[model samples]
Target: MSSDAPVGARPPAGKTFFGHPRALSTLFLTEMWERFSFYGMRAILVLYLTAAVADGGLDLGESSANAVYGTYNAMVYLMALPGGWVADRLIGARRSVLWGGVVIAAGHYVMAIPTGWSVFAGMALIVLGTGLLKPNISTMVGDLYERDSPRRDAGFSIFYMGINLGAFIAPLITGFLGERINWHLGFGAAAVGMTFGVLQYVLGRRNLGDAGARPADPLLGADRRRALTRIGVATVILLAVLLVLLVAGWFTVDTVVNLLTVVTVLVTVGYFARILTDREISGTERSRMKAYVWLFLFAASFWLIYDQAGSVLNIFAADRTDRSLGGFTFPASWLQSVNPILIIIGAPLAAALWLKLGHRVSTPTKFAVGLVLNGLSFVLMAAAAQAAVGGDLVSPLWLVAVYAIQVAGELSLSPVGLSATTKLAPVKYASQMLGLWFLATAVGDAIGGQVARLADTWSQPVYFLTFGLASVVLGLAAVMFTRQIRHLMAGIH
Candidate 1:
C-alpha cells in the first residue's frame, strides 16, 4: 500500500513505536526538542529584556518589555497562517520542517552573539522559522494516521506528551544557565537544543515514509510564479513601511509592537468576515460559525491571561517572590516548569474525566468552566500581589498555585477548542479552520500584550483583580448564554 494508505488498509505492521508506526518517534522527538528551545528561550526573554545593562541586558522598562513579549508571541502564532500557505503552495511539509529547523537553529545562534541588536534580529528570525515549523509539524503528525482511525487521536495524545515534556524541562536548565551565568549562554543552550532536534530529524527521515513528502495542494506553473511574485511584493512593501517609520523617527519598539498587534486584530476580523459573508456556506454551517465566534472569544480571553506566564508573571517572580534557598537563590525562570509539569500530571486525568462525562457536558460549559477557573487563578494572583506589596517577598507557592489553576483552565479549554474548531468548520473552509483557531491565540496575545502595559503603571493587586473580576463576569455571562450558543452550534457537541 502507498504511505498515504490508512493503517487499517495496510498489511500487518512489522516494527512499531509503542504499537504505532515508527515515524511517531521521529515526530515526537522533533517536537520535543523544538519545544525545549522555544520554551527555554521564552522563560528568560522578559527577564533578559528588563535586566540591567551592567548585567549584559537590554534594560528595557517593564511596560515595553511586556509589550515586546506579547507582540513577539503574537507574531510567532500569526506567522503560522503564511507558514501553512507556503508549505501548501511552495514547499511540501517535509521540506518546510527541514528548512524551518535550519532557520530556527540559526536564529538561536544569532541570539548567542552577545550584542544588543542581535537579540531582536534573532527574535525576528525565530518568529519566521517557528511560523514555518509549528503548523507544518503538526500537519505531518496528522499525515501519519488516517482521518478516521481510532489511533489518530491516540497518536496526537502521544505527541502532546512530547510537547509537555519539552516544556517541562526547558526552564530548569535554561533558567539556571541564563540567570546565574550570562544570559547569552542560556540562549546558546536553546540553540544546542534546536540543533539536536534538527540533526535527529534529518537522521530519522527514513522512518517518516511518504508523509508530508509532497504538498496536499500544490500551485503549479503560472500560479506558482504569481504566488511568488505576490510574496516578494508583500515583503518589499513591508520593508518600505519599516524604512518610512525609521526615517520618520516613529520606529520605536513600542510603536512596532502596537502596529503588529493592530495588524493581528485586523487579520482576525477580516478572516471572520470573509467566512461569515461567503455565499457558499450552508445555513447550518453559518450557524455553527456563529457559535464558533463565541467560543473563539472565550479562547482568546483564556490565552490572553494564560500566556502571560512568561511575561507579567515571570517579572513578578523576579521582583516579588523570594527565590532564596539556603544561600542558593533559585532562578525565577525555574518556576515556569510548574505549568507543564502540572499539565503532564493532570492531562490524563482531564482526558479521563471528559471521557467519563461524555456528551452530558457541552463544549460551551467546558469553556465556561475554563474561563471561571482562569479568572480564579488571577483572583488568587491578586492576593499574591497584595502580599508582595511594601517590598515584602511572597512565597514561590503563590505562583505555583496560580499556575496550577491556569493549567486546569488550559486542560478544560484548549483541547476542547481544537476539537470544536474542527467540528464547526464549514466544509468549504475546512483547512482554514485550524488557521482560525490559531488566530484566536494571536489575537489574544496581541491584545494581552497591550493590556500588560497597565502592569507597569497600576498597582499589581489592582491590575490582577480588575482583569480577574472581568474574566469571572465573562464566564458567568457565558453560563447564561450556554443554551443560545448551543442552539447556534446546530447540534455540534
Candidate 2:
C-alpha cells in the first residue's frame, strides 16, 4: 500500500515490521493500542461499579455491575454490524478507522473524569468508537498483503500477537492504577494508550497507500441523506422505547439481559434463513451454507462458554480465588492476563500440531475435537467448584489450568472457523458472512450474560456441572454427525 513505491513493489528494502510490509507496523501498532484501551477498561469496570461510592465507584451492586458489564460487551460486538456497513458504503475504512480512534480516545478521557454519570457517557462513546474501529482496522491488516502472498499468513499471525500482547498487558497496567492507585488514573492510562496509537497512526499511514482508501460501495448524495434519515428515525424510536421502559419502572438489569437474549435469537435465526433462502447460490453453495449453519451452532456454543472468562470467571477470581502469594496479595484483574499468556505460548505449538496432523484429519473432525475440549474445560471447573470444601481456598492453578485448556479449545476451532467461513460462504455475500460470524459471538455473549446471572441463584457445583454436561453432550453430538456436516461442506475441506 506504500504510495511512493511503484505498483507491486515491496515495502522499502530496509527493516520491515517483523519481515512483513511496513504498512503492518502502522496497523499493528494502532490495533495494539486500541486493544490496550479496550481491555484495560474492561479489566476493572465491574470492580469499580460494585465498590462503595466513597471509594470512587457508583455502588451499582454485584448483579447490576455484572449486567452492565455483560451488556456493554454484547453491544460492542452488536455495533460492529452497522459499523462494517457504514465503512463499506458511506465512508472508506481508512477515514472510518482514523475517526474511530478519535472517538475511542474521547471515550477514555470521559471515563477519566471524577463523576458517576460520566461512566455511562464513557461506555456509550467507547461502544460506538469500538464498533467503528475494530472491524475496519482488521480489514486494513489484509490490505498489507497481496492475494496468495506467502507472507500473508505470517503477517496475520504477527498481527494476532499484537492483539494478545495488548490484551496481556492491559490489565496489568490498568488494574494496578485502577485498583491500587486510583480509578480515574487507570482510565487516564487507557486514554493515553489510544492517544499514542492515534499519533503513531497519523505519522505512519502513508505506508498503507490506497488500501481501504475508497469504499467498496460508495453511496450517492441523495442515498446518503436517506440513509442518515433512516438512521435518525431508528435512533428516535429506540430512545422512545427506552424512555417508556424507564417511566414504567421496567428499565432494570434483568430486563436488558432478557431483551438482548430474545434479540440475539432472532438475529441468529434471521441470518441463517437469509443465506439458506438466497436463490442466487448454486446447489453446492447451498449445501455449504447448511454446513456453515452447523458450524455457527458449534461456534456459538464455544463462545457462550469461552466468553465467561472475562465476566463470570473474572468475578470468581476476585471473590473466590485466593490471590495471595505468601502474604502479598495481587489485584484480581491480573488473572485476566493468563489466557493471553497461554495463547502466546500455545499458539505456535497448536499451529505446529495442526500442520503435522493436516494430512490425517478433517476440519469438521478438528472442530468436534475443539468442542469436546471446551466441554472438558468446564468439567475441570466443575470439579474445582466441588472441591472447594468447607469454604477452603482453592489453588490458583485450578483457574490457570482451566484457562490454559480453554485456549486449546479456542485454537482448535476458531482459526478453522474463520477459514471455513470464507471458503463456504457464497461469493456475493462475502462480507455479510463475516459480519454474521461476528454476530455469532454477540449472540453468545448476550446469552452468556443471562447465564452469568445464575451465579447468584445456583450453587457453584450445580451451575458448573450442568453447563459442563451440556457442553459435553453437544460435543458428542457434533462428533456423531461430523461426517454428515463434512459431506454438506461439499469439498470445502
Candidate 3:
C-alpha cells in the first residue's frame, strides 16, 4: 500500500526542482490551476447573481442568490470526506487528481454557458471535482518526499506558494472578465486554466513513479459488495427524500445548504464522542482529547467568520466598497488578493513572535487571541456598514484593515492548531484525529454558508453585530478555560 511507503521515496530519475523530485512541479502546477479555477469562479459568483438583468446576471433575489452561493461553497467542503474515501478505497490518488481536473474543467465550461441550468450544473460538477482533487493533491505532495526528509517541509511550503499565487491572480483576471465584461467569458477562462492543468498533469504523470499509483487500502470482494450495497441504499434514500421535498416545494438550494450544515455539526459531534469513549485510548490521551475538543470549537468559530472573505466579504467589496483610486478603478475580485498578500507578509513576523516568546504564551491563549481578532474584524465590518448606511461606497482601506486584523488571527490559529492536533492525537487514532481537524474547516464553511444566506433579510448592522459579538464571546470563553484546557492537554503544547 502506498500508505506504508514514504512519499517521494524513490530517487530522482530524469529531472529535479530545487533539489527535490521533479514531480513536485507537476503536482504544484496542477494544484495552482485548480485553485485558480475555484477561486476565479468564486470571485464572480455572488457578483454575477446580484448584477442587473441587463448586465447578463440571473437577476435573482439576494436571499436566493446568497443561499445558493453558500450551499455551493459548503458542498465543496462537505464532499471531501467521501472523496478521500473513494481515493483511498477505490482508486489511487494519481487517477483521482487526473479525473478531478478533467471534471473541474468540464464544470467550468458548463458554467460558461448563458443559461439557468448551466449555473447549477456547473456548481455540482465543480463540487465533485474539488472533493476529489483537494485531499488527494496534498497527499501526493507528501508522497513527493522521503520520510523525515528536511526537504519535505520546504517542498510543501513551495507547493503552498502555488496555491497563494493562483488564488491571488485568479480574482484579478476572472473578476475583470466576469464583472466588467462578460460572465461566460470569465467562466470560459477558468475552463482554459483547468484544461491546461489537466494537460500538464498528464505530461508529468511519470514523474510521480509509484506514489499513489495504488490505493492505500483496497476493499476485498465481499467488503466491496457490502459497501456497494450500502451506497446504493443511501443513494436511493437520498433521492427519495429529494423527490418528496421538491414536490412539496421545500427543497430549494438553500434548504440543501442548511441541511449540510446540520450534517457537518452532527459528524463532528459523533467523532468527538467516539474518541472520548474509546476504551483503547490511554488516560493521558483522553485528557489531551478534551483539550482538543475546546480547541476545535474555537478554531471552527474563527473560520466561521473568516471564510466569509469569499462570500459575504466578496459581496461587500463588489457593491459597497470603493474600488477607485484617482480615476483608476479595479475589479471587486481583486479584493480577495489582500488575504494572501497579508499572509505572505505576516507569516515570518508571526513565527518570530512565537519564537521570541518561546512558550511564554500557551497554545490555547494563542487560539483565543485569534478568535478575538476574528470578532474584531467583523466589528470593523459593522462599522463599515454603518458608514455605508447613507448609500456611499466605503473606502477600500476599510476592507483591507479588516483583512489585516483577521490575518493576524489566522496566522496565530491555523498552524498552531495543526501542530497541536498532531501532538494531542492518540497513536491508534492518529489519522482520525487529523481527519477531525480538517472537519473543522468543513464545518466552519458550512456554517458560514448558512449565515451568508441571510444577506438579504438581515440588516447589515444587525448581521455583523450578531456574529461579531458571538465570536468575541467564544474567544473570551476559550480564554477563560485556557488553564483548564492546558491541564487536560497534559503538556502536549
Model 3 regions lying over 4 Å from their true place: 1-14
- TM values, all candidates: 0.97, 0.93, 0.94
- In model 2, the runs with Cα more than 4 Å from the true position are 1-15
lDDT of 3 at 39: 86
Q: Residue-wise lDDT of candidate 1 within 1-493, one digit each (tens)?
A: 0113323222223468888888888889999999999999999999999999999899999999999999999999999988888887788788999998889989999999999988898999999999999888888887777766788778888999999999989999999999999999999999999999999999988888777777777899999999999989999999999999999999999899999999999999999999999999999999999999999999999889889999999999999999999999999999999999999999999999999999899999999999999999999999999999999999999999999999999999998998899899998888768888988999989999999999999999999999988888998899999999999999899
Model 2: which ten-residue window has the lowest total lDDT?
1-10
C-alpha lDDT (0 to 100) for residue 128 of candidate 3 = 88
* lDDT of the candidates, in the order given: 0.91, 0.82, 0.83
Looking at model 1, the pairs that clash are none
Better of 1 and 3 by TM-score: 1
Clashing residue pairs in all predictions, respectively, total: 0, 1, 2
lDDT of 3 by residue, 1-493 (tens): 1222333346345689877789989998999999899988888888887778899998877666766676676678667767777777888777888888999999999999998679788988998898888878887787766666778877877887888788878888998899888998899888999999999999988898776776667677999889889989998998898899899999876677677678778888887899899999999999999889889888888888998887788888888888998898899888988898788778778988998998899999999999999999999899998888878899999999999999999999998897798789888776445567778887787777777767678888779888988898888988898889999999876
Per-residue lDDT of 172-270 in model 2, one digit per residue for the tens? 999989988888899999999999999999998878876677776778899999998999999999899889989999987668667866876787798
Given candidate 2, what's the lDDT at residue 157?
90
